[model samples]
Target: MSAVPILGVIEGFYGRPWTPAQRGRLFARMAAWGMNTFLYAPKDDRWHRQLWRDPYPEAEAEALRGLVEDACQHGLQFVYALAPGLDLDWADDGDRRALAEKFVHVQRLGVEHFSLLFDDIPYAVDRAAQAREQVSATHHVMDTLWPDGQAGLLLLCPTEYCGERAAPSVATSPYLKALGEGLRPGVEILWTGPQVVSTEISVQSVREVNEILRRPVMIWDNLHANDFTLHRVNLGPYAGRPLELRGLVAGLLSNPNNQLELNTPGLFSLTDYASGKSDWTPEASLDRALEVWLPAFNTSSIHRVSLDDLRLVSHLLYLPGGLGPQAVRVLDVARALVNPQTGAEEREALVRELRTVRHRVITVLRALEAGPNRDLLFDLHPYLVDVAEELQRLIVWASHRGEDDPEVFSYRGSLADRLMTLGWKT
Candidate 1:
């Protein structure tokens, strides 16, 4: 009914969930940006996945109640997701009841939106049958908790939730076909484009999945998630999807980076995309995001953080397997610095450029430490440490060594640098 509705965030990453204060800040920001939904589905939240059948402790329940109330206050629809796929017995009536009761408890606490996620678990032996069973389970809960189909925005995240993960393919997967055939008329499916962290989601891919699902799928956007690569955090603008994509999907929700503080740029970028920035480009969104986000980097304006510094940092840590324009330029300079036949004058300039990058890393690190925003500093501390460490290695090579030493190539950080040498297994 709400046109191309449900632009939101799903706290569904596999790491420490955001703290209450952090969530409060997010709710406020989401409202300001006109995002309409918030899904609570953090994978490591034991109660959300591991302890799915158990009731939340009084304190936890009260905390969730307050969260839901606050979200509604800000005009954000709060969705509570139950990830019981880890050990669910589709055949068991007791398990079905447990799932329904779990929803009933939270429904009392004011969670109008609910979803059942059957993702990340082992594939069922009979995929088609399993698909049917999963849909039946969702329907059972719907029938038990809110008969007459009055439940708010219901969703399911199938085990094969993306094109890459689907057995054989999305077009031919019996699992998906069965899932589509069995889905209740109003229930929605959550899909993560082609890959778990797809760099691009084309129109054709969406059309294929939509054809199979028999409905417009809701996007569980993972462009900004960094949980898989702990040393990285993506501050890139949401790119890779066509602007016309909004018309193809039922909704789109970002399952972003675990570090809430680092998500400001990414979430804002998604908001602009979802809320209709008619002429959005990742580069432009990134520039706008940097301007808005740079203020947080400044502690007192004395140890100031310039947009240039943030832009550099973001470009370096832009996205998974992606290099920002500046990052690419820096690498090109580095390559030239190490080239054997490069003239001394040009080599000197290349080395200077690298030294400048390292210098900026130190400056940003110092400014971050000078923060009134310790949380942002804490979240970024690991990456800055890694960057600083690598910058040192790069500078050492560019300034002193023109030759590529085998020893120099093995400068992996953390325990890998110490323990895992060139041929440990061999």
Candidate 2:
């Protein structure tokens, strides 16, 4: 009936350090936007460190109490993350007892939800079984330590791609299924289906896994966090920037999960979702794209480029790979569409020139086939061999000619040159 509740993870597992005041402000902002859950997963914060075990420093404990109190005041649940999965060094009984004490203390502060991270924790050297045991032991500790056997919901971040098989091979599937089944019964599983990036996963695929594990599965679909590196926003290079919000909304509505998160960077991705620009004009969309790109493109040096120039550039290069050579060509065409820089007759001639070049590139790509020439491509292809084959589909899309006498890549390797040549003020 109502929209799904999205959990905005503040002080994520990775990011710039946030002061208490900063965290309080972040929570308040999420609350203002109707967010209901906050997952605190800072790796080396003082509150969750090994030293926190000592007589439970009153001042530090009270500071945490204030965070929890602030969250409740804004109608949000504060999910404290214990480092057992990723921080197994802190999983020893002594450390566990200390953490248990801290958890109990936090309960008194009115915080109930907690998460156990097992995702990025390095595997043990000798036997793989030992790593699984280590994770189980930590869950066992939390199961017993929580007040009344269920102080709050326990969120498990298992080792195998959030409990999905890496390959369909029998050897791997059995191990993943076992890990999923082995998790505590009442605990909620944070499953990030196979890949952490934006992916097309069906509801049926999710239901099958949930049936096998016999537990409620929470989808942690990372539609934006591609490299596992946080802070890079996922707005499209040009016009598609606002369009990305549609993909995010589709993912949210695709599956009605009790929880959803904007896993991109900083604020929300897509200006429409972030700043709420909904006019949908060719000129307006270009301006939004430049607002995102100019800062990222001109990071190293001072550049005097107005937002209008950025808008003009972005409207032309709206391809998925962003403002690459292909996008630049597209921008040139879009500009030519309205008014030709040279002349009316010359504008038609420019389009023909671009089309001829695009035709040649397409022939070159189709010849590559597979196998030997695969290594010629860049991006996640060679690194993640499986996804490389899929990249071939992108070539055709990227090769499409733009309207303005298809802009040429004069300096093949220079990103700056490509931008400057395509009418972008340098």
Candidate 3:
């Protein structure tokens, strides 16, 4: 296997697409981070998915041409993807021609790589027949465009792309077996491990799919995806998958959070994993990424809050587990405040620490509000504002011997409401 696997970022989330400027910035970042591919498959793009046969307007075509040029200049392969399975008549020759023609139009814009997506659509009654038709149609398109195999990369996302959606089982499913055997060897298939939003991707699982497909798979990782629920955001470092995965697959493309600015740390840590860094750990990688990420706020006050502290808060938001050391310490303070046996000195100490955390959160939030990363602030503003407000209430209660004032009761009610929104325990 090569030392560095083909690392890429797929803008394949179910939300608003990034603007042209955001994409230009993303290409430059991908180049600097040593990523080699960018898959443009935003699910909300009307023409790319719903109206797959329609031609792009003059202005949209110009924008796409410019994006292709930018990607090429950055040494990135811009893979143009179209999801036509929603209403495509795969057996019709006219439908096949339309699919080929749409791709050819993109090819004229200098995009050499292409993908045909059949994911998220309902399965046909005759599964095997559906699979065969999908394979045949894709083969026809590929043969028509690149008879000599000059098309840089032709990728496919089968309808049953993950383990849970695979009927009966992965090894015994007739639809998968047909796809594995019928599709041309030149074409690659995309997989999302055992589940759509997989918490862990093991080598054994990859090997199972690889044996069935007789080829290495390209991972479309949705670990950091937040489209399923708007209230959640994943900011934790990339973990769970072992480093041995570098040799098991063709490439790893992360489907990141909708908020563009918050994805820097996650993508940076993924780059470290792909680069084969022996010393890489998720905690350390997150800290290092934050060093570069926090400075973007252009605020001097942000220097006072440590990256570890920020990670502690973000970890609670994204990952599933008990609180970390910082949260544990804060909880301990809260407990002591409510304990009748606690002394004044202990209460004061706890109050001081809580006040400090509150101040740090305020400083960071203020900087974020005033900074250029408006997207990041928009995603996290509510959470930050709530934390600051809760901290103030906690401070006042701790100072006043857990007084049952209206403000404290109101804070308790608001805390419960916030926790419900995030699906977290109050």
Candidate 4:
């Protein structure tokens, strides 16, 4: 059997609503690039409200249907993304029923592909209650909407950040289990594993979720989206280059939010890359990763010397020795010292008090490694080699620390200053 076509972004071309002219142009462009699917789910677009309950005036509804028809003619499936949880906040039972009615209405529009987007809903809510309610409502509505029970494809976005939020590593929530039970057999789950923007997926976890949910898992990768604290690390091409997110999956979806400012050529090239038509090499993908990660590294670049530059010194010392529990703690301290948060400053008093302590510790280690101290050096050399390997990783990660927190710059700057004073080389 052939692989399912990769889905590309359908939201915000040029960072704004696609005027009719723009939509037509984009539709043709997408089809030409071998992209077969476009997810039409815009967060801020009120016009999409027409897809539910005929909210749009007659003329507008006709216009939307026309767009759908055009998409079908071009051999592309336009997936309607219904913001059930985000837009239709079901604070009460009535709101839930109303949402169901809207789903029924949209089903009448001959729209085959549908997505129940529960993403971005507050996780603090009674998740179990929300899941059951959504499942029951969806099942009930789709029953009435498609009496024959032959609904086309259904996509469900569970209440977590699929590819952007990478915590709660395990997807064994009770709410999710309940959702699986309530889901109609034909429903396809858009499973967002706990690893947001994760290049390496835990296949065991993937298998576990599939077995539990009893649905084919389609990975929703946010390759083009850049969310640092929440979802840092861009996974897609940045400069009209291809960033192949290689993975063993049933299908791939590029969930680009409103951030991508892709030009026509860039868009087409990305579409080709996603569709697996273009030659996407691993080297090319790594190059794209570097482009996205390099800027962050620049913010936290460290000079060779400046042991007084606490963070860099700690990085240099800690990495080569291996990342022990104490090592991690010291590095954290160095990081905090260099770019002390307001609260950190109030507690540490500019980290001056700890300078002597840090220097003493390094001096002792160096003494242990002295040439005449053969036994100590012999024991420490192996450990130092191990530490060096880990330190290299730390350096690479520190170089990009600014991607998540720009404040890491303060540490980089102070480290550079200390290095210059100490006459250290890069």
Q: Which ten residues in a row have the lowest lDDT in candidate 4?
A: 229-238
* Per-residue lDDT of candidate 1, residues 246-293 (tens digit): 899999899999999899889888887775566768888888888888
* Model 1 CA deviation exceeding 4 Å by range: 1-3, 401-413, 418-426
lDDT winner between 1 and 4, please give it: 1
Q: C-alpha displacement of 306 in model 3, angstroms?
A: 3.6
Model 3, which residues run further than 4 Å from truth?
Answer: 301-305, 320-352, 372-375, 390-426
Candidate lDDT (C-alpha), each: 0.85, 0.46, 0.80, 0.50
lDDT of 4 by residue, 16-97 (tens): 4555555665677667656677677665556444334335566766776787788888787877767656455556776667
Cα error, residue 8 of model 1, in Å, equals 1.0
Candidate 3 residue lDDT tens string, 304-413:
44675576556545442234456667777777776878898987888888888777777677777776677777867877787776676667666764455524254455
TM-score of 1: 0.93
> Mind giving the per-residue lDDT tens digits that candidate 2 earns over 109-129?
666887665666565543246
Which of 2 and 4 is the better model by TM-score?
4
**RMSD over all Cα atoms, model 1:** 3.4
For all predicted structures, in order, the TM-scores are: 0.93, 0.54, 0.87, 0.55
Which candidate has the top score in TM-score? 1
Query: What RMSD does each model have against the real structure?
Result: 3.4, 13.5, 3.7, 16.2
So what's the TM-score on candidate 2? 0.54
Worst 10 residues of 3 by lDDT: 417-426
